[model samples]
Each structure stands twice: as structure tokens, then as C-alpha cells.
Target chain A: MKSRLRVLRAERGWSQADLAERIGVSRQAVNALETDKHDPSLGLAFRIAAVFDRAVEEIFDNPHRTEGPG
Target chain B: MNPFTTGPASREYQLATAGWFTLYGVILFTVAWAVDGRGLAAPWVYPAAVAPALPIAGFLWTVLRFMDRSDEYVRAVLGKTYVIAVHLTLLLCVAWGFLEVYAGFRHLALFWVFPVFWVAVAVTGRFIRTTR
Candidate 1:
């Protein structure tokens, strides 16, 4: 899944480690999520959203949702 | 330091693994001394032979506990690595079995399977991407 995690983290002046600490995961996990190498689980996505004070959809682009009819 | 190894869960897993492996070595040595040096009799030797396996089970339990306590990405990466390691170990052992039967290869001890699986895990983990 595509994510704006890098952008979001950058805007907040947070390093990968900073964001990872906030989300209770390793920095590598933050990098993986930012690079689209791994998709976060629902719980992790919620946690990330909570950390950023945004909606999950705001961070992650839902490909399935985009494929549906308007 | 690897981020995966920095957490409390990792520390606990490491300690548990060390404890279990140490126990395994001690039990194995004691059993060997009893059976070979002291001429331990039959029936009793059976349980003695099986004693070392308990610590191996404990070692596996530590891995499970570590995975349960890890974050989602670490758990996912480790889960995949273990699956790959299991398949690799199975393939190697099966091929060796066939070779021993048909090609005059020497028989390998079954206890080697545990170490072989860990070797496979190390190799697969080296090549597998844990991060981007």
C-alpha cells in the first residue's frame, strides 16, 4: 500500500526512529512502511494514525477503495 | 546494534535461549557419561536418552514467546524466515536421505537436523529483506 508516512514524519520534524518510537516499533519498520516494502497491520495503522493525529486513510492510500465505483 | 535485538523481548529471548542450550549440553554430557562410561542399564537409559530433548523444546518455546512479544514487522519477518528455514531444512534432509539410500552416502545423525534448521535460518535471514 502507498503511504505518505515519510512526508508526514518530515512535516512533524520526526526521524524514522522518532516515529517508530511513537508507534512502538523498530525504526526499520518505519522505513519499511515509508518505502512501501511492508504494509502495516490494522492495529499498527491505527497506532500510526494516532501518533500522527490523522486518519488512517490520510496516511495510507487504499487501493481497493480507489478501484470501486464512485 | 540491530533494532530487533535492542528491545526487552529480545533480551529475554536471548537469556532463555542461552539457559536452555546450557541445560541441553549438561544433560547430554551427563547422559553420555552414564550410558557410556558408567554402563547405565536398559529401560532407565531410555528416559535418560530422552532427557536432553526437553531443553530443546524449551528453546523452541523461547522463539515462540519472542515472536508473540515482538512488534508486527519483526514478527512477520521472523515468521517468514522460520517458514523458509523449515522448508530448506526439510529439503536438505530429504535429499540426504535419498542419497544415503542410493549413492552410498554416510548416514547423518537425526540430532543434526536441529542445527541444520538454524543454519538454514541464518542463511535465509541473510538474504531476506528485513527492511527496505
Candidate 2:
């Protein structure tokens, strides 16, 4: 899964630790999420969305999903 | 709290852990000395022998507090790691049990359980964190 967590966090001018603290997670976790080394669980995706005031789908995308022709 | 866990531990938790272990160690030494030198003649000897368990309880409390202080992502990572650790530990223990029963091997000590579980968790966590 690819995420816009870095973009959203950068827009807020918050460092990884700041975002981690806000989200109640370690900074290492935030780093892992931004680098796509780890994927977030549903509950974590919701938490991240809540932090950014965005829908979960807006933040994370499943690259494996295919789009059908309109 | 007692130098365990990958996540950070609070100062109070660390202090309590250290203090408890120090006390536990002292009590353990005292018990061993009394048993060896003077024998378990006194009524208090039995209670003194088990005093080391108090620190184990304190260590467990610190572990709980450390987990509570960690963020959700860290907790999730650790929770998954714990599951892996449990599975590995269980398999090792079961295999060892079978070996003892079928092959006439010496019985293993119960105290090796936590060490095996934690070691598995540490190794698995490293791999999980590094790999996609």
C-alpha cells in the first residue's frame, strides 16, 4: 500500500516524531509508514485519516487493485 | 521496565524495576546463604526463599506499563511479533517435550520459557520491521 501520510504530515509542518506523538505511535512507526515498509491495519488507517481530517481511501491506495473501463 | 521491550520505558517504571531487582537479588543471596550455612531451620526461611518472586511481579507490571505507553503502530508490531514468538516457543517446547518422552532426554527447566519466547520475539520483530 502506498500512502500520502508524508504529504499530509509535511503540509502540517510536523516532523515524523510530531506526527507520531499526535497519533500515539512511535516515530519509527511513522517512518516505516511513510517509506511504505509497513502497511497500516484498518484501525490504524482510520486513526491516520482522523489525524489528517481525510477519508481513509484518500490517504492509502492499494496498487494491486485494477480499475475497470468506464 | 527491567531492561525489556523494544519500546521506551518511563523513568518511574525503570526505577521501580531496578529497585525491585536489587531487593530481589539481595533476598535471593540471603536465602541461599542461610540455607547453605545455617540450614532452613527458622520459620522465616521459607518466605525469604520466595521473596525473589516479588520482583518478577514488579517486572511484569513494568512490561505492561511500557506497552501502554507505546503508540498503536508499535503495539501492533509488537502484538504481531508476540504471536510469532508464542508460536515458535510453543513448537520448541512441544518438540522438546516429545524428545524427553520418546528419546529419554533429560527434562528441561520451566524457567527457559520466557527466554525462548522473548528471543523469538526479538528476532522476528527485526525481520518484520526490515522486510516489506
Candidate 3:
């Protein structure tokens, strides 16, 4: 899944290591997440959201979601 | 500290693995000495031969504990590596067994399986790309 984690971290002026430390994950994990090589589990997603101070959707793109008719 | 491992759990796992291997080496040497140099009896040698397995069990326990303490991503990566390693080891063992039976190849010791599995793990881990 694609994520705006890199952009969000950049906006916050946080290096990958800084963000990884804040989220209690390794820098390599953070790199993998940002590169879309790894997807976060539900619990990890929530933790990432909490660390970013945003909803999970704001950081990770949900490819499964479809637009409903108005 | 293993390059693939990170965080506090990594340190713990490394220490545990070292301890287990150290114990394994000592037990193995002792058993060999008893069986060979000291001429241990048949009945006693059977139980003595199994002594090194205790440290192997400890190593396996350490692996399980490390998995429990690892984060989701590391666990996932390791899970994949193990799966691949298991399959590879099994395939090789089966093929070698056929060769031994049909082609009159020399019989391989069962203890070699553990080392073969570890070799497979090392090979697969290189390609699997775990977090450093």
C-alpha cells in the first residue's frame, strides 16, 4: 500500500530515524513502509497514526476503498 | 548483535543464542570425550548422545522468544525467510535421500539436517531483505 509517510515526515522535519524512534520501530522498517515494500498491520497502523497525530487514512492510502454513488 | 536484528529484543536474542551455542559446544565436546576417549558404555552412551540436544532446544526457545518480542515487520520478514528455508531444506534432503537410495551415494548423517537448515536460512535471509 502506498503511504504519504515520507511527505508527512518531511513536512514535520523529522528524519526517518527520528520518525522510526517516535513510532518505536526500526529505521529500516520506516524506510520499508515509506517505500511501499512493507504494509503495516492494523495495530501498527494505529500506532503510526498516533505518532503522526493523524488518522491512519491520512498517512496510508486505502486501495480497497471505493467511492459510493451520491 | 545480528545485523538483521534491531532494538532491545535483538540484544536479548543475540545473548541468548550465544549462551545456547556455548552450552551446545561444551556439551558436545563432553559427550564426544566420554564416548571416545573414556570409552563410555553402550547403554550410557545413548543418553549421553542426546545431551547436546538440550542446548539446541534452548536455541529454538530463544528464536521463539525473539519472534514474540519482534515488531510486526521484522516478524513478517523472518516468517517468510523461515518458510523458504524449510521448503528448501526439505527439498534438498528429499533429493539427497533419493540419490543415496538409488545412486548408491554415501549416507548422510541426520545431524547434518540442522546445519543444512541453517545454511538454507542464511541463503534465504540474504534475499529476503530484513530490516537491519
Off by over 4 Å in 1: A67-70, B1-4, B130-132
Query: Candidate 1 falls in which docking quality class?
Result: acceptable
lDDT of 3 by residue, A1-70 (tens): 8889999999999998899889888777888888787888898899999988989887888887776222
Question: How many residue pairs clash in each candidate at the backbone level?
Answer: 0, 1, 0
Candidate with best lDDT: 1
Model 2 lDDT per residue over A1-70, tens place = 7888999999999998899878776677788889876788778789889999988878888665576222
* Model 3, span B1-132: residue lDDT tens: 232566788789889977987887899899999999999998999999999888878877888888887767777777888899999999999999999999999999887887798789889877886433
What TM-score quantifies how close candidate 3 is to the native fold?
0.90
Best by DockQ: 1
The CA lDDT at B105 in model 3 is: 93
What tens-digit string does per-residue lDDT give for candidate 1 at A1-70? 8999999999999998899889998876788788787899999999989988988888899887846333
A best-first ranking of the candidates according to their DockQ comes to: 1, 3, 2
